[model samples]
Each structure stands twice: as structure tokens, then as C-alpha cells.
Target: MHLRIIALALTAVLTSCAGVQVHRVTDRNQPGIRYWRPAPYLALVETRTENAVACEVRPLMLPDKTEEYAITINAGLGSVKATPTLTDGWNLVSLNAEADSKTSENLTALATLLKTGAEIKARGVTKPPTQPVPTCRGVFRVDYDAAGNFKGFSRISL
Candidate 1:
């Protein structure tokens, strides 16, 4: 009976933590093509045990002067708000759209730095460039651990 209670309690605690949070954050510091407005990027945050364990950002489609942009999250496991089933290893969480033109440019520059063996920073987050920056049509694959912590991202082939 005591073991059952302990298992239930642990399950409840784990359930509360297994999810993903996504939002758009505007980076006014990054240069925009218009020279007056900074571009926006999507911030993907992973939570485990109700605490954010990892974060990554990707550029969104640039908004034209006359159009409004809205960001949405679509996960492979269902809504990002849904609790994910615990597994023994990593799971693919979300598949995001391709990099925008501005992002492509920034990524190209970062790739150059990588070739030189220099560290690179993307939107203030410094990490080594993993794979070649995808073109505007390439899709992004985001993965997470069993505990809902972000693992990393990979580009899907066209």
C-alpha cells in the first residue's frame, strides 16, 4: 500500500513537468532589412518537473510592412501543452518551418565562423554550429529527452 502511494505521488509530479512552451520573442538588437524594425524569432523552451531546462530560438517568417504575423506551435505528439508520455530515451517533439531569409543569412555567417573553428552566437545564445544551415525550405526537427528537457535540433532533408 505504501509503495502504491509513493508511485502515485511520483507520477503526479512527473506529469506536471513533461511539456513544451513556445513563444515569439522580438529581437530589436538584430538588424532588420527595413532598418527601422527588428525581426522576431520563436523561442522554444523545454520544461521538466515544472522548470525550464533548455531553450532554443529560430527565426520566423519576416512580416511585410502591411501584414501581421502570428506564431503557433504544432507538435508531433499533439499539442505542446499536452503532457508527453515518458520514454526511455529521446523523442522528437516539434517540427518547425524553415529558416527565413534573414535567418539563412545569419546562419550562413555562423557556418563561416564554424569553418574557421571560431565559436558562434545566435540571438545571444552561443553554441557550436551543428549542421549546415538549412535553406528557406528546409524543416527543423526539435527533440527532447524523456523528462521533457530539450535535446537538440536537426534539419530534415527536402
Candidate 2:
């Protein structure tokens, strides 16, 4: 019985580590007042649990990137809220559409990803913070632990 338990534990660890998927996606529906704002290149992940999210995130384009963006996932409520810090990496250019149907679809997609234990990475360029600022772009490698917890996001060359 002890041996069986150990095997199960080992299997769980391996599964958690191997179950995660990370990649870059363009979210054209950036949320905000401006309609012509540029879209952002987002690196999103789908893990097995919520703990897989990192307290900090560093992307290749914005190495100084932090978890300045707040994304809330309420699986029970089927809702999500993302607020940007307006900082260099978390600037509004990477924003998402909040109240529109397309935004709803996007959030729903985001919810599905998080519900399955996923993470997102987005970067924006546009230093002057101007209205016609360029879109944020970046590439990243997602790192996680065997226990299904997020370790960190490692910046990688595109």
C-alpha cells in the first residue's frame, strides 16, 4: 500500500509539470476608452491549478516587467477582471476590451484558460504613452514546478 501511494504521488507530480502549455497570442480587443488602440502580444499559459501563477513576470521585450496587471478569475462566477498598472510593461496599450461582446468572448476565453490553470503574458511598446502608441510585444518561456505551482516566466529570444 505504501508503494502504491508513492507511485501515485510521483505520477501526480509528473502530470502537473507536463500539463502546462505556454504561448503568445494577440489580443486585439484591448479594454479601454480608446477604440483604435493597438493590440498586444500576449503570452498565456494553461496549468493544472491556480497556484501555477507567478507573483512576478519578466518578458523578453520588457525584462523589467512585473505582475503590474491584475487579472482576477472567478471560476465559480464565470467572470474575469483585468486592470493594468499603467507602468512600462503593464501599460494601457496592452489593455483588453472590458464591456463589449468581443471583450466578453475574449474574457470567456481567458476564463477557460485560467479555469484550467493557465497564465498570460502581454507586452506593449509606445514609450511616450501617446494615443497612437505602438502595440506591446514579447516572447516568453513559462516555468513551473512539479506541484502545479508557477515558478516564474523566463524571457526568451523571439
Name the top lDDT candidate: 2
Tell me the deviation in Å of residue 42 in model 1: 8.1
Poorest stretch of ten by lDDT in candidate 2: 16-25
Candidate 1, 71-144: lDDT as tens digits: 22223222233222212222212223332233233344334423322211121223332443434344455444
Most accurate candidate by TM-score: 2
lDDT of 2 by residue, 16-35 (tens): 33111212223435332221
lDDT against the true structure, per candidate, is 0.34, 0.35
- Model 1: CA > 4 A from native: 1-137
Clashing pairs in 1: none
- The clash count of every prediction, one per candidate, is 0, 15
User: What TM-score, over all chains together, does every model reach?
Assistant: 0.17, 0.19
True-structure lDDT of candidate 2: 0.35
